[model samples]
Target chain A: MINRTRYLTQSVAKILIWIGALSTIAMMILILFQILREGLPVLHLGFFLDSPKNMGREGGIFTTIVGTVALTAVAIIVGAPLGVGTAIFLREYTRESKTSRVIRFGTDCLAGVPSIIFGLFGFVFFVIRLNMGWSILSGGLTLAAMILPTVISTAEESIKTIPSSYREVSYSLGGTRWQTITRVVLPSALPGIFTGILLSIGRSIGETAAIILTAGSSLVMPTSLFSPSRTMSVHFYILAREGISMKMAYGTGAALILLVLMVNIIAQWLINRYIRHRT
Target chain B: MAMKEKIIEKILLLTAFSSIFILGLITFFIFKEGLPLILKIGIKAFLLGEKWIPSKGLFGVFPMIVSSFWVTFGALLLGIPLGLACAIFLSELIPPSVGLLLRPAIQLLAAIPSVIYGFWGLIVLVPLIQNHFGGPGLSILAGSLVLGFMILPTIITISEDSLKALPPTYKAGALALGATHWQTIWRVLIPAARSGVVASVILGMGRAIGETMAMIMILGNAVKMPTSFLDSARTLTTNIGIEMGYASGDHRQALFATGVVLFFIIMALNTLAISLSRRRVH
Candidate 1:
């Protein structure tokens, strides 16, 4: 009887564990089904290619899509080099220095700050103080700051994972530290750096609050970096809040999700391909 | 050649070091804009005042603060157990092949933009809550549920990683002592990974509090104190999102102050999480 009871309890525990594993798939499917059910009917070619006109009565999301891509591209352009440079310093140049520790602490603090605070800071500093006046530049720069910590930390980790043997070999061959890092260490850590960049891209594309405050709600395609622009995330928020048009909002949302999903899929594919090649 | 190369390397290092200075400048800008508002409103009135009528020069954030905490607490209560269970399942029970397939799906959930969550919540979740709970189309319940789903991925991923990181010797020892797998997980593995699990939950809490788009979409945007989980509520992030458009004068400053409070809460939670994780490392 005791042996039978033990068997029963073990079986029950196994069942519970299986249930827990399946729950993740269940939740993902549920969310996908719900989004498609709500968003699919509104999807169309015009919705993708046209710009919202006269309070979003007509046209597609052309302007918003362009704005999102442009803003994200600008943010990447501004943030990536700074992030990569900082990582290089932390991992390669400043090894064991007090400045490196301080830099790491600062990056961690920056990462901890919430998105809304960044938004508030952008509103006051970028829009009011600098008189940038709610343009794509302001939005992109604020997002750059918001994502810098993530990029720096991830990049630093990737760099640190490189084996010191390669650097030592180069140094023994009379190579300077900079040459060793650029020629050997960086190549070894390239895949990880790519991963960091992909993650930051994912973050910047999905970010809404900082962009909303810094980039004014303008439906027009930004003619220049200094002009105001509306990202897909911000547009989705504005439409939903104002109860503008349910169909348009849902369509725009689907587009935003599709964009993010595509980026993630591409990143994963690249990482997988790189790993396979390396192995 | 050596000295010249050294100077170039030092210059590059200085440029890299300047990024930290840039981060400090950003933080200083936030404090400079927000501190004056906090000082003007005074801590007592800001913390204790019941009203949040910024239009009338009343900058009371008590309602928003309470509502933010209420919804975040509700979300935590709903999400933590489910996330932990999922983490345990993934780390201990599932076959390797199945775990591999499911891991990407969980990561994809994290990749979904918050706006889509907001849109879905506005169209579906809010209406469902209103029909069942007899409130307006927005409520703390709606916000919490959506926010709970939004942070679910973070909690599950982090906790599962931590659980996986635990040394296998503990589990082996437990099973060798005639303990069931579940008992081993609950008693030994979980206790060993407690700091990591706690960090995951705290991170989720921070995410929920800072989430703007989804909360604003589902929380009814009412600046009133939530009487129940089903009542319409406004979080600090949602408040800033909803009102930053046309707010001016003291009203805008009050929003800045609200942002300040939100910042500190997140900072505290994050500091605790970092220190706890660091302690676990040692």
Candidate 2:
């Protein structure tokens, strides 16, 4: 009788667990379905290429798309080198130093600070003090700061995972430390580095608060780095908050989700391919 | 040959060392921009002042601070148990194939952008609460619920890993002693994984406090202190995002002051989390 009871309980527990797991999947499908249901009718070629004007319902998100791409590009350009540099320092150069430990602590602290705080800092330091004045440059720099910790941590992990044998082989070939890092170690870890970059790009694309604060919501296509611009995420927020047509908001939202999803899929594929190739 | 190699090595070392300077620059910029505002506002007024009106130079961040803590605490209250239970089910009770499907689904939930969450909360959740509870569409309850779902993945993933890491012998020992599976989980697995569970909770709290877009959208952006769970409230993150756009003069500084306070709170939480995890590592 006890054995039967135990089996019954286990079966019940398994059912419960399955229910919990399925609920999450169901939620995601529901969200995607809702978004497509509301958003699909409005999606068009013009919607992707047109700029926002006349209360944003009639106009498309061309400028916002361009602005997002520009800001992300600039952020990657500015942040990637620094992040990779920091990672190299942590893993290869100062593996056990007090200064590196402090750097690691500070990086971790920076990572945990809220995105909104980064916005405030960006507003004061970049927009005002540096006189960038809520332009693309300010927004990009802010995003660079926001994503630095992510890049550093991911890069560091990737670097750490590179087998010591690769480094030893390079050294045996009489390669200098720099050569070993630049060639053997980094090549082995290239996929992880790319993964970090892709993750940062996804984060930058989805970011709303930091950009809204630092990047002024000018609906026009940015003329230059110093000019104000609106990103898709920011546009989505504005449309949602200002009581625009729900159809328009959903349309823009679907576009935003699609963009992120595409990037995520591509990045995951690239990382997987790289892993397979290396193996 | 020796000289050339030495020079190249020095250059590589210099490039590596520059990261230290970059980290320093980040901290310096944060404090440099934020400290003066704190000094001018006076720490007492900044912490305790009721009103946040910046026109007359009163920059009290107390209400925002209260709201931040309130939302975080509320989220923790809801998310921790559900997340832990989910983790327990995943780690202990579930079959391998089911665990695999569930794990990715949880990650996908985490990967969904906060803006989508805000939209979902606005359209679906806020109305549900308002219809039942009779308040404005935006309320602390809405914020907590949205944030609870947002941080659920964090807690679940961390707690699941911790539970998974427990020695199999521990479970067997309990089973041999005639403890039921549920009893062993409640009495043995949980206690043994206490530190990790604590870390997961802290991490969840950190995410909750830091979250901006969804909270801002759902919390009604009310600047006043919350009177009840149904009352609308603003958090430090939302306040910063809302005001940072047009703020100038003392108002801007006050925003930076808010950032400073947020920075310290997160810093403290992260330190605690790291130390706890390090202890477990040792």
Candidate 3:
């Protein structure tokens, strides 16, 4: 009788677990499907080519797209070098010491600081204090700070995976430390590091709070680093919030989703290829 | 060559310290902007006073603080079960091939912007809640549901990692001792991985609390204390996000003070999570 009850309990528990897992997956699919169904019709070539008009009630999101691209480019250019250098220092130049631990703790804490806090800092320090005004430079620098921890951690993890024997081989071959890192370790870690950069790009593309504060919500085409601009995420937020035009919001959201999807797909493919090649 | 290596090392070390330097500057500026207001109003009045009118010089954030906790608590209630289920499913129940496919799907869920989530909540969830629950669609309930989903990836990924990190002998020994699969998971494996699972939940709480744009979209800008999930409310993040554009003088300082409170809360949670995970490692 006890054994019978045990089997029944297990079966019931299993069913509940299956329901929980399936519902989560179903919810994800439903969100994706609902957005795409409403959004795909609005996406066209013109939507990508023309700038907005009439407070974003009409016209396309071309300027927002440019803003997103420029902002992401600046973030990657500034953030990637700093992040990879930090990772290299952590993994190659330092041992497990107080200094390394403090740096790691700082990175982790920075990761936990919310995006809005970064926006506040950018507004005060970059926009006001530094006299950058509401421009792409301020916004991009804030995003770089926001994505710094992610890049550092990913780069460090990848660098840590490179076999020590490779470094030993380089040294035995009379290669300098700089030469070994540049030619051997970094090359082997490229796929992983590249994946991190891709992930950061995706993040920079979607960030809204920091962008709106530091970049200013200008719908005009961003001509230079000093010009104020609007990103797609910020554009979507304003449209949907103020009830400007639901259709344009859907289009912008669709475009943003597609961009993120493309990034994740590329990152996943790279990771899979790297694993396969390694094995 | 040696000299070149030394120079490169110095550069890298400077880079390594950049994050710390940036963090210090962020804290310093936020406090510098915020601390004067707090001192002027008194910390107790700023934190515990119920009113938050910036124009009249009332700058208390008690209601927002309450709403932030309530919304985050509601999110945790919904997210923890779903996340644990998915984590267990990925770590134990599913085949590796199936898990591989599902894993990226979760990562993609994370990659989807918070604004998109906010958009979805606005379009679909608010109306659903209004029609069925008999309240304005923009309630704490709406915010919670959206945030619940937003935090899934954080909870699932970390919990699954901890579960996967367990020694194989644990499962084998439990089974060999005649424990059923469910029994082994519930009585042995989960108990063993408790620290990690707890850490994931804490981190999820941090994410839910720190979330801004989505809450600003779904949670209506009611400043009064929320008595129920049906009432519209605002969070600390939404407060800062909504008002920063037009706010100046004491009002602007008040928003930064709000951010100061948020910053401390997140740092505390992060330190707790790090300590918990460190315990798991040993």
**True-vs-predicted CA distance for residue B48, candidate 1, Å:** 1.1
Candidate 1 lDDT by residue in tens digits, B90-177: 8988788787667767778888888778877887888888788787968898888888888888799879988988888999999999
Clashing pairs in 3: none
- Please give, as one word, the docking class of candidate 3: high
Please, what are the lDDT tens digits per residue for candidate 1 over residues A78-164? 888788878887877767778876776677767767777788888888888999999998898888887788678777876876778
Cα-based lDDT at residue B196, candidate 1 = 90
List residue ranges in candidate 2 displaced over 4 A. A1-17, A270-279, B1-34, B89-102, B164-184
DockQ of each: 0.59, 0.45, 0.82
CAPRI tier for the interface of model 1: medium
Give the winner by lDDT. Answer: 3
The docking quality of candidate 2, as DockQ, is 0.45
Between candidates 2 and 3, which one is better according to lDDT?
3
As for lDDT, the candidate ahead, 1 or 2, is 2
Ranking by DockQ: 3, 1, 2
* Models sorted by TM-score, best on top: 3, 1, 2
Per-model tally of clashing residue pairs:
2, 0, 0
RMSD to the hidden true structure, all candidates = 2.2, 2.9, 0.9
TM-score of 3: 0.99
